[model samples]
Structure formats: C-alpha cells, structure tokens
Target: MLRSFTKYLFAPALALAATATTLVVAAAPADAAVVSVRVKGSLAARTGAANWFGKTRTIKNKQKVTVTCRVSGQYLRGNVRKTAQWDRTLIGDYISHAYVSGNPKLPVCAPPAPAPVAAVPMGPTGTMTNEQFLAAAIGPAQQSQRDTKVPASVTLAQAILESGWGRSSLSANDNNFFGMKCFNNAPGSYAAGCKSYSTQECTAQGACTTTVATFRTYRGSVDSFRDHGANLKSLSRYAAAFNYTNNPNQFIAEVHKGGYATDPQYTTKVVNLMAKYNLYQYDLKV
Candidate 1:
C-alpha cells in the first residue's frame, strides 16, 4: 500500500538552512528597487510514487540579495507554497529538512519508499487463527503505547470499518471499500448511488430521510487501499499523521481526528473492531 519516493540530498549543516543567513540585493535599473536575494540551499527534484508536487531551488547562505518581500505564488504548488497562513507553520516543519545552513554544494538525492509505520500481524494462512492476528496486532500498540500517530494498521482499520469486513453491499458488489462518492449529478447507475432502506440522508429542511446514498465503486480492495493512502498523503491535514506512521493506533486516531469518518464513535469503534479481530497486530512492523 506504500509508494516509493526519492531520498532528499543533504549537505553539511553549514551548507543547509540550519542557521539564518543575510539577504543580498542585486542592482536593477533606476525604476526598480534593488531586488533582494537571500542565501539558502537549493533543493533537488523529488521522486516518489506518491503524488507530492515539489521542486528544487537554491537559497544563498550569508549572501545578501534584495527582492520584493510581497511576492506570492513564487514557490511551487503542493510544496508548502499553497498552504493557508495557519497551515504554513505545520507544513514548514516537515519540509525544513530539505534546506541547508551554509549553502554547501549538495546534489539531489532521490526520495526513498516510505517504511511501514507498523507491522501487520499475520499467521500461517492455513492454520492461522484469529487469536494469532489479535496477538500480532497488539504487539505494536504495546511497544508504543500511544494513539496520536498514523500507522499502517490504522489505514487497514479504516477500510474494515467502511467496508464491514468486505461484507457490505458496496464491498461485495462494487469493491468500494472506502465508500467514496461522486458529485450529486454524476452519470451512470451511480447517479442515485445504491441507496439502503435504513440509511439516512439529509434534506434541505434539515430533516433526515431514510435514503442511504450510493457509495462509489472501485476495481478491487487493493485499489481502495492505494487510493486511500494517496488521498491521505495529498492533503495537508494528514501531514502530521505521516510522522506517526510507526504507530497504527495513533495513526488511526489521527485519521479520525482528521475527520476520516462521519461516525460519532469512529475512533472507538475502529479500536474495538481491531481488538476484536486482533487487527492491531498488523501494525507492529517497521
């Protein structure tokens, strides 16, 4: 369910943005105020199967340059440049590693595949029992007693919650484990979605109707999982969750916090279900 990414090339701390540097200004025509230039390390191209739009740029070190301070959209999109003011601090913390201090001559390094946040507990296919899965899933949770991170198990847990152990009508008939939806006017049989009798829908009057909406269908469970991870990685809100990839319980909790599900007890139910099936064991690996 994970995609490979390139490793970021790094130089010595002095060459990187570990410390602040002076800004330099270049002489322009009389009409133009001298443009400001800042010394900073440039980033190289990023390579990851996950869809993160990042680019490389060089910021000078100790060199003062002049430029307009009010420039917006100067940085690349999807690379912390498009975030709102509130989210800037959060996004910056994750990408700060790409910059260097002294402007050392460093080359671009490819991103590497993300490691599993936790191990997936499994047993022999034939003789394997649910008990084994339970034991394996709890190992990682016990090793790291916390639930504020994102773990691989959390992702699996979400799928199980949405798909009902691959037994839901959506999962059984459409392979739509995550229950995604299209715009209301979407075409084909999905226009109305596979509604359920007891499912509730909201109306303009703010009243609930017993009309369950149709969930989007997928080609397979693998597709659901891949897209699920990609969706999480694409959004800025889930950025912090990636750091907690080593802990599934925390990861699941974060996803819940991120509003991954609409259920009132989404987190509680997910945790309970994982324990019931020993699913936490799946998140114990590196």
Candidate 2:
C-alpha cells in the first residue's frame, strides 16, 4: 500500500510539561543545527522520511521535540500546516513538519552520496559485455532458484532479455530488471515504490502499442531478481512452471503459456537466449 499521508486529528492538547527530555540526534552532521518545535497534535514519528517506514513512536500534543534537520518527503497536511517537509528528530525519527507548531528554520539534510559504480569489462561498442552481465547475474539467479525453486537459467535468461543486458533505463536506473509492473504497492512487499515509464506492449495477436505504465521499483538488482522469483512462485498462473524447475526451457515455456508476457514469441526469445548463452548450466537441481 502506498504510505498514507492522511493526518489524524486528535483530542485537544492536555496540560503537560512544555518540553520533553533532550534526545541525541543521529545521522546529522556534527555542524548541523538543531531546533525544537512543539507538536501541534498527536502524531506518529516514523523511522524513515516516508510514512511507509515503521513507526518509531507517537508524540503527543504540546510535546517539544528536538529536530536536527529537514528533508522533503511524503506530502502531509496536519493541524499546523501542510507540507512535504519532514523533520529529522534528535532521536533519529522523522516527523511531518505539518504537525509541528514552531517555525524554526532547519538545515536541509545532506543528500546521500551516490553508490560507487563498479567498473565492468565493456564490449567493443562500449557496453557491458554479455559475458560480464552473465557473470554478475549468476549469483542472484542461483540464489533465486534456491529461494523459489525457479530455474536459475530461466531467471538469468529473463534478465538478459527483459533488461537488454542491463542497458534498459529501467534496469540501469531503477534496478527493475524484469519490467515488473506494479499491480499493488503493498507495504513490506518487494516493491519499495512505483515509477512511471513509457513501454511497448504487445497483444496476443501480435498487435503492439506504446503506452505509459507504472512499474515496480527495487532498492537494488538483487531485490529485483528475488522479487521475480517470488512473483512466479506466488502466482497461480505460473505454478506449472515450478513443476519443471530442473528444466529451464520447459519452465520458461510454461511461464510464457501462463501469460507472463503478451508477446507470442516471449518464450522462444527467452529460450533462444538461454540456449545461445548456455544459460542452462546455471540451473540448480530441484
């Protein structure tokens, strides 16, 4: 489920201490400034900037909470105001700025540094070589097989075909290697969120159309791989594929027959890739 940005109204403020005990801020830079703000109403403080994250505590009305920095997050409308700003507290919890009464200015939290990119062996055309892509994918594919009883070869082949060897923008930018669409943004699911993209989809009759759609987003490629296996395992339509876990070709054909993709040749394409690349060697014995 998408995080609920709905703010709940509570009873009027009670007669309590104006301030609570000080809390040491976490994840703030040493020189970062701290500010205190009274809670306008009872509200939850979350572990992350987004409401989807776990709730840390419920801060009652009129309580003074010390905040270290601020960052843009889920838009919230509360008693004090409406805003996308979230205040990071001394206790490292995130509270919606819309619930805080004080107008104290806070420093913008520094954006997390980008993850270091690993240098991969590039082909003559300056793209990741097919061999290099397979090398990187083998571990995740086999792990998925171990976890879901899906053939590692089928997983690797799907990754290769769907992601274009990690060249597609979705795979490169969002780590969504399987082009997995978001049917439901359920909390604690493999999907962290959804991202919109333009894609070409085909009908059973081979009629194709370009359309904009929302696809599932993952924290990393490993999550994408895991989700792919779990998705196949969970769906009743794809259950027959599990019967052929030791046969990558038969497994992928069953997946295609179950309408995993609209393309009529989806199974052939995946199987061709597997055969050409000797992907069956990666399949785990079920």
Best candidate (score: lDDT): 2
**Candidate 2 structure quality by residue, lDDT tens digits, 53-148:** 999898876677778788999886545566799889888889777656545668898786999986532211114687777888888888888889
Model 2 TM-score, all chains together: 0.55
- How many collisions per candidate? 62, 3
Structural similarity to truth (TM-score) of each candidate: 0.40, 0.55
Model 1 residue 72 lDDT?
17
C-alpha lDDT of candidate 1 relative to the true structure: 0.44
User: For model 1, how does the per-residue alpha-carbon lDDT over 77-120 read when each residue is reduced to its tens digit?
Assistant: 22212221110111121122222122222223224379867644
Every candidate's CA RMSD? 20.1, 17.5
Tell me the deviation in Å of residue 241 in model 1. Answer: 2.3
Best by TM-score: 2
Root-mean-square deviation of Cα positions for candidate 1 versus the true structure, in angstroms: 20.1
Taking all chains together, the TM-score of candidate 1 against the true structure is: 0.40
lDDT for 29 in candidate 2 is 42
Q: Which ten residues in a row have the lowest lDDT in candidate 1?
A: 84-93
